[model samples]
Target: MSIEVRSLSKRYGRTWAVRNLSFEVQPGRVTGFLGPNGAGKSTTMRSIVGLDRPTSGEALIGGKRYAQQPAPLREVGTLLDAKSAHRSRRAVDHLRTVAATHGISRARIEEVIGITGLESVATRRAGAFSLGMAQRLGIAVALLGDPHTLILDEPVNGLDPEGVTWIRELLGSLAAEGRTVFLSSHLLAELALVAEQVVIIGRGELIADAPIAALTAETERVRVRTGQLEQLLRLLAADGVQATSLTPDTADIVGLPVDDMARRAAASGIVLLEIAPIHRTLEEAYSELTREAVEYRAGLTEQDAS
Candidate 1:
């Protein structure tokens, strides 16, 4: 299954939450949905699941709107919020209820419980569960129907390290099975590891829709340390390589391959103590893309980032 968001726009009276956003999430891959706070990511996901009405355009799953599917759960599984389950209901009961509505069997419910690592807390009341447990239950609910497509928002909100690793593997395996997994997460490093492509939105507009590598390709940099700094600089300057000095003997070269630099410096008699490629992080790329579109720029304080 694939998710298609075509010019999807949603307005709340005088303000537009999402405007003219369009992107396609293909099957057989995990596509990340990323944006800053108040960037309309939640609104867009809700609209895709039919939880919010779009003022203009539409969102589709497998070429049909979410409401058009006769068995929606069987086609699309969503984890919009970890606290979506009934407060007083047992975790197992919550799964059973959702499963029952879709004619899902008891065996499948048990399977999902195991899949989400919720077996130990299955009988616990949801209201009494901790945040991490609730996140597991929410994921269990999403997996109960064995849906072809999953739409999750901040699925790792309160998970421990082990849980985080588990979910990463699960999502990767699901995508390998040709399922469409549209995930939104604030953890950029984790997303970079799991997602092959990303759809970035900013202030209700589409900023980027590309492979992770493509987005960060221009940010490729290489770090170098040479005892003969002047000799290395002259050689690099002769080659027209853009290098920014980081220290008296070290520099950061833009878009230079480590092997190429090492080979060139060796040929030029520039003894390099260290030569390594410093790949740009996804967070760095995202920061550059959304800088102009950010609604609020927070200033650091002694009480803030301490």
Candidate 2:
């Protein structure tokens, strides 16, 4: 199954949460839905699963709107909010209740409980469960119908390191099985590890939609270290290449390949100690991309202010 959001828009009173956003999430891959706080990630996901109606355009699963499906849960499972379940209900009872509505058997519910690692807490009231447990329960509920597509919002919000790894492996396996997996999270590094494609939005507008490799390749830099760093810097400056001095002997050069830098240095009689490309991490890439789009930004410290 594939998800397509075409010219989708959402509004809350006078504010537009998502405006003219469009993207395609292909099957057999994990697509990371990324944005800064209040950038409308949740709003877009909610609209996709029919929890919130779009103000304009459409969000379709397999070329049809979510509500048009006769068996919605069996087609697309969603974990929009971890706490959407009744707090007083036991974990097992909660899944069973949701399954009953779809006529899903109890055996399938148990399988999902085990799949989500919620077997130990199956009989516990949701209110008494920790946030991590609650997240697991929510995932179990989403997987109850054995859906072909999964949409999750901040699925790792309160997980421990082990639980985080577990979720990562599980998502990868699901996508390997040719299921469509779309998720949003604040953990950019973790997203980089799992997501093959990324869809980034800023201020409710589409900013970037591309493969992870392509996005990171756009920010690649060459790091050069030499005793003649100043001479190399001057040479690079004259060539219109952007460079940043990291240390007295090391400089980071952008818009220039490592081999080209080394050749230039050798031509200038500048002996090179080290030269290599520095690949930007997903966190760095995200910070740079959304720097201007962030809704809330922290102020500089007192020392910096001084």
TM-score of each: 0.93, 0.90
lDDT by residue for model 1 (1-306), tens: 789999999999888889999999999999999987778999999999999999999999999999999999899999988998889999999998999899999999999999988888899899998888998898888888899999999998899999899999999999999999999998999999899999999889999999999887774588899888878878778666888998999999875677887898899788899888887789999999999877756673222100
Report RMSD (Å) for each prediction in the order shown: 3.1, 4.3
- lDDT measured at residue 67 in model 1 versus the true structure, 0 to 100: 96
lDDT of 2 by residue, 1-306 (tens): 899999999999999999999999999999999988779898898889888898998999999899898888898889988998798999999998999989999999989988988888899999999889999999998898899999999999999999999999999999999999999988989999999999999989998999888878764599888999999899888778898899999988898778888888899899999999999787877888888888866673322100
Error of 2 at 22 (Å): 1.7
Q: Give the C-alpha miss distance for residue 176 in model 2, angstroms.
A: 1.4
Scored against the true structure, residue 254 in model 1 reaches a CA lDDT of 77
Candidate achieving the largest TM-score: 1
**Once all C-alphas are superposed, what RMSD does model 1 give against the true structure?**
3.1
